[model samples]
Target: MIESDQNTVITKINRSWSVLSSNPIEFKAINGEINPDDNSYHFAIPVVFSESEPMAAVALEISKSHAVNLSVAMYGLDASDLSEDEIIDVCCEMCNVFSANVCNSFSGKNEGNINVPNKLSSEVFRYIFKGSNLERYYQAENEHGRVVIYMFDPCNYYN
Candidate 1:
């Protein structure tokens, strides 16, 4: 069990992006519950960590408000003119970067390998992490817009 405050976790997450890429991404926790039913944002990038038993996973989803700006910061190109594939690639990188920071918060963390990111069109996340109780959900926003991150352990849903 990692004994850190949630704000500290958020700080680590924000720092991770800066350390990983030239563009440092700043995120602040959104002050509300995530309406699981909200499907306004359809696409997502899922990153899985499998270094130990009962694996862990993280997912990143960008909000419409910052979609274009984030895409630009992520790829160093104009989001106003990028293709679908480019956006997916950026989102994948975001998930990977965020996952590493998350792993650092765990007690028995190792150099976990991230599974290939999945680009989904619906609410498949509930099915993916069906019974995870050791889960953390964060909705954050930057100058561009909002990004949501979810961290969960597969084997500890009920515990």
Candidate 2:
């Protein structure tokens, strides 16, 4: 069963995904699911938002395959037909939307910005959770395999 808090984050993440994409994606909170091998995702995009200093921050990681699927769905394009640059653009839009949604959940304002999206080696995903104390990790499967969403506070306490 999903824990209460984890369920909340999962709902938010799924809602973000749905609202951002023209296609609907239902994400369940899969408690205790293992993080897939780092090599599994060829690209990782991290979107971070902070309300202020030291209170709380939210970060999201999206796998390349999932991002591509999302882009294809949102744009009504064939995934196999998209160029690499187009896929990257879609991923950045997903990051922007997801980051704005998560940030608004904390700030009550619908405005948020993304840092330039990074196409990082798999190793970068490993360090994402390092400083987080309160974290909720969720897993969902689409045709592309498993997509993971992580929500956490970077400090020992979250306001």
Candidate 3:
């Protein structure tokens, strides 16, 4: 994709996050590589760009504490008694929402379908990140923790 297209996609991704979070969230495109924190939760979902043709995958890496904080903020849930699985589920739901938002933004471009979100091990996320061409890498931070969003093109596993 060209630079303008990349910017449009990044802007849409940022807007999607802003729409999702009750708290302020600002996403900036990163200039270099990023190492996912060991305590972070990772996820990816496949998106079909044009009627059964898979084009990309969107991934997220967010710290554990941030996941809990986001769950509370987004769902008004009590985080005090939340389990790890519950937190992961919330993150997965957020990923699903994000993917849907992105797909809608590109609706004119035949981007319509998004598959189920999958919780990924850090190792698996890293492996995919290394092998794929990253179309965008964006990071946003709040008082809770950090979140990184990855948009990869020519999705290897999906395509």
Candidate 4:
């Protein structure tokens, strides 16, 4: 991705988070490894061309506490009342929404097809990203907790 495209992706990501949570979020570009904790939740969505070929993907790694807080904010439920499955569901929906937004920005209005978000283990996440070109890595945090967004060209994986 070029510099301007990277900026657009970051802007869309910030906008998506703002739309999702009422809490204020601060995003910063990060370097080095972006390994999430073992307890973190991982979700990924593919951005596909009209011909159904994946060109890119967006992956999200959010802390467990952040996921719970997001669920409480989204569903108006108490944290203690939220189950693990409920948290995963909410996070998956979040991944789907934001990844769609980012993919639309890349493929133009209504031109990109965003696949369903998949929940994965950290090991799987790392395996899929291995040897792929990481276009950007960003970290966002607020009172809720931390979230890491990874933008990458999956096409490079098969190169």
What local distance difference test score does each model get? 0.58, 0.54, 0.75, 0.74
Q: Which residue pairs show collisions in model 2? A: none
lDDT of candidate 2 over 29-70, digit per residue (tens): 555645545644433233334456444334345556777777
Candidate 4 root-mean-square deviation in Å? 3.5
Higher-scoring candidate on lDDT, 1 or 3: 3
In the order shown, the candidates' Cα RMSDs to the true structure are 4.6, 5.6, 3.3, 3.5
Runs of candidate 3 with Cα error greater than 4 angstroms are: 1-22, 50-55, 104-109
Query: Model 1, 1-159: lDDT tens per residue?
Result: 433556787888877656544544666655445644344243333333453366666666666545555567666876578887776676666676777666555445555555666665544655554556336666655564566777665533212
lDDT for residue 129 in candidate 2, whole number 0-100: 46
TM-score for candidate 4, please give it: 0.79
Question: Which numbered prediction scores highest in TM-score against the true structure?
Answer: 4
- TM-scores for all candidates: the values are 0.67, 0.61, 0.78, 0.79
The residue pairs in collision within model 1 are 133-157
Which window of 10 residues has the lowest lDDT sum in candidate 1?
39-48
Task: Give one clash count per candidate, in the order shown.
Answer: 1, 0, 0, 0
Model 1 misplaced regions, further than 4 Å = 1-8, 17-33, 37-52, 107-111, 129-131, 142-145, 155-159
- Model 4 error, position 98 (Å): 1.6
